[model samples]
Target: MKNSIAIRREDLNKKGEKRVAVIPELAKTIIEAGHNLRVQSQKHPETNENKRAFSDSAYADLGATITEDIAGARVVIGLKEVKTEYIAPNTTYLCFSHTHKAQIKNREMLRTFKDRKTTLIDYELMVNADKARVITAFTYFAGYAGMIDTLWTAGQRYALAGQLHPFAAIPQSIETEDLNIIKKLIQDIGTHISENGTPDDLPPFINVILGQGKTSTGAQEIYDILPVENITLAQIPEIYANGDRKKVYKCVLGITEMFRLKAAASLPAHTYAALTIPQKESHYFQHPSDFESNLQAILPYASILMNCILWAPQFPRLLSRTFTKAQWEQHQTLIAIGDITCDPEGSIEFSQETWIDDPVFIYNPATNTSTLSMEGQGIAVMAVTNLPCEFSADASTEFSANLSPYLPGIIAANYEASLENSQLPEAIQKAVILWNGEFTPRYAYMQDYL
Candidate 1:
């Protein structure tokens, strides 16, 4: 059969997930190859002020069929997970199915795919020959939006406490679609800090960033816009005790520095060296139980915590209720937490995934509950799950550019052929989680989860 690919609209249930897997420019490539292309009519914000990466009309103009009939196509594509009810039997579906981690919530969705005999390909598992990720995600933007939002939330928290500072002058991430506006705001905040210095009313401000991965790099980009000093972890105490309050500080932590063996007071030099060494078989600490959280030592001095680490069920909580409550009672300087990973009850135990419209909530350690407003006693959390949507245009363009290389292989695959005989690229073949409803060999481990 001739290849026919369909691009489905993002699930409406997920707010701010406005990204499209196949932009119009890429759609033209698929159409020019003499293959059938179908795109769902995407819905956008009603106001013309909101900037969209591309219009639905743009897809139609490229000689592609634009409609809501996603089920009619042989291969379906999307940015996020599709609803199980929309999964057509015997059809190949490609998207980010988060079930790789055996998430309980997605167990039923995986079972439904098996029952419907649908072929599932997960984008997250697409890796190169070296097992490194081929599709670089919008993680940088997640950090960018997260850091910007964290500073804005901290400003609001200070206002509620009747403390005025330079952060108050900053704007929300969504206030303007143009990234330059946000960059200028960050620059302005830096200028103000450099000139007037931090207010005496506020405690010494230190931003602790966890993980030095792509997410942290993105967060640092926004943070560097401010006139701040980068200090080593060993220097934190000295600066906190005698450093200038007028200036801000930043510290980045790696895996070894963030956690130590549960039984040992500190990680030994050999173990630390083994983990720190690069290109050495990628060996590190085996299990989460082997380590204990080492974040408590720095909690007293932090004004903002940007968590960029990837956490799973096996990992220990970065900050527990007891620790947070004690710090809150002491009236610690920590005011805002940017849980950029947005894992619900994951790394940051008090964290819950928040929407773009309602991005922040105050987590009351005393009550162990959350309130929408940043007022009252508690630390404010900026946990927007879909941070990239704030810069959807640029994110989509980057995402599509990375995905373009695999398009021909994806569209030309013969779904009828046996899994091993299929003409898909090795990367795509490796990403197949389900073949005709049964778990693929690479993903058979998910069978227990099902």
Candidate 2:
């Protein structure tokens, strides 16, 4: 029998997630391949605009059946995880199921997939022969949006404190998707800063960025639009001591610079380099307890903290509550934390997953409470979970292009076949987190988490 596939609308509750797994252009490809293609009708959450990335009319025009009967299809595709109650039994569902690390929050959802005998394929795990990610993500936009949002939040906080500067003129990321518009705005801000210089009221400010990955690159792209000075991690202390009220300074730190072994004082420099040189791989730190946070030295000088590194429960936090409180009380220079990774209570312990509409919150380390406004005595946190959604059109187009190649194989695969005999491509096979409601061999480690 021919296979049937359905593309469901993202959960309405997930605001600003305008990305569609199968765009209308890809719908045509699936239909031409002789598979039954269906798309659920959906309206853009921003109803005032009345625009959707893939309108129902567009899918229908491409010869795809437009209907709400998603459960009728054998295979379901979506951009985000579907609610446990909405997942139908015995269906192949593909999405970014963030359960790879045994996330406590997603344990119930993973259990539901097992109980329903649903096949769960996680997009994040889709890898090529090199074990590198095959699925393109919105990481670039995450960094871009995060930096823009963080700068804007910092401006707001500064304005409330009666200090007006170039950042005050900056607009929100959601206001426009045109990179040129943002560039122009930042250019103007840069010009203003160069000519007028920062106000004497505020001290010399430095933006410390952690991680050198795509996310960090994206943040740097936005920051580079201004008249900024790049400083090395080793020079941070000297720059802070001398102070540069004329131009904004940025420092990017790698893993070796950001962390140290617990016994770094006694260990030889060569031994430390050997242990931390291969930083990207988990093998570097055999245990989380082996490392101590080295971020404190920079905290006293940082005006903005851009955390772009990936963090898991097994890893030590880059910024702890005690450290944050001490910095806020003593220096008062760290105005905002742009947590691009947005791992709730993961890396930046004080940061919580915030929404796009209300992107920032003031985390009061003293009370361990968060306030939506920046008026309180706390550090502003920009932790938008869906940062890339700000540029949904661009993100969806790139993601669809990357995901198209695997569609033909996925649509033709026989899910009933045993794991070893499955017709799915190796990339897809490796990505299957759950097969027939049980953890695949590659993902069996997740059983303990579930």
Candidate 3:
């Protein structure tokens, strides 16, 4: 039985990705379940100390082998996209490939997957029959850290503009020891805002959060702790007019509010309006081109924008570059944007890649130019590509628990057999983009990329 499973160390290309796929506790679980386990070491030629939350000896203490070369392992699991050179042929690999939307970056990697007869199981595509996500720990944590980092940048942006606010006191997520510490500091900030109201020099703080899924929920969990008022979209102008400086105004924009039917005016009276909420959502999703962005109504008043929408090309961009430049030309009130969706111009149209070390860049809507400087005129965009890795230990612990239940089936899956004769769980089978050298039917549409 080729029952050995290994964890791949993140490659050098992953600049700030400091997470391990398998932590010590999960290593023990895999070993206890009657499988040989190996984890890649972080050290150069096996250094005693590494950056992982757990020591390498911890895995060895749990009756697991620690080595650098996971390439020979029959089954390898990891986080993020595997480096092209590190991808081994004829092995079953599990990770987020980021190739689903036909990303040009991974086009060659997909070609490699086909040519090398690799069996790739993408963690991102592991959805049920109805498209409900099964593994979501990473997403929630990503939002959790994203919000914290958002505050960090928002505070800096304010300080640069010489504004007096409590947000300037908040620290980045990576600076904290853990999630609890981050919460404590934010709670203290909330208390401060409660005791002393925000400065009158600045306009009303109208914070907008896009999307209501786990990612948005996690961000709101942190945001709601602040002295804030949750407002409806219709009440935005009222809040801006007579809102309290002691409180931050929060608004969540879902798909229905983000987009409106472009053909609504052409339809008969109460035609699109008569449809149920679900019906409207389905109609927009099924025919995205029929809708146009309705986000401009809220943008001019928003102080901070936290974007967490699931964006694809078919759907309209949450903020088009053209719209952003035009909107800023009139009344630009946006201060900072926490683009947790981090698709680099996919959702927040001006969002470009920023790293953990230099985590923020100022995107100038006026000039359609960007600079890494925190000061000057532009919306400070905090688009850290790997937010979850800032809370790597916490994220990994939750991920280990979520992956626990599915481990047995994933380990026992028969990848040697043909896709038709395979014994993988139905959900897992559906996530397999490549099974035994051939692209799965569901992913056959990716053929055009090659």
* Model 1: per-residue Cα lDDT over 175-228, one tens digit each: 775677889877877878888888876666899999998889999999988877
Clashes of each: 1, 0, 0
- Per-model CA lDDT versus the true structure: 0.81, 0.82, 0.83
Model 2, 1-450: lDDT tens digits are 368999887776677777777778877888998999888776634453323465788889888887767776889998777888889999999998888987787889899998999899988888999987887557788888889999998898899988886787787788896656887899888888888888877777789999998899989999998878999988888888776676899999887778766664455546666654575235435656667678878887888999999888878888888877766676666889999898888888878888888888898877778988667887899898888878777777778888889988888889888867878889999999989898898999988886
lDDT of 1 at 300: 77
| TM-scores vs. true structure, each candidate | 0.92, 0.92, 0.96
Model 2 RMSD in angstroms: 2.6
The 10-residue segment with the lowest total lDDT in model 2: 43-52
- Deviation from native of the Cα of residue 68 in model 1, angstroms: 1.3
**Which one wins on lDDT?**
3
Off by over 4 Å in 1: 44-52, 264-284
- How well is each residue in 1-450 modelled by candidate 3, as lDDT tens digits? 337799777766666566776778877877888888888775535344344666778888888788876766778988888777888889988998999898888888888988888998998888878888778888999889999999889888888878868999999888874999889889999888888877888888888999999999999998988988989999998898888888888999888888877855344436778988888888778878778788888888998899998899888887888988888898878899999989987967788877787889888888999898687787889998888888888888888777777777887667778766667777788899998678899998887889
- CA RMSD for every model? 2.9, 2.6, 1.9
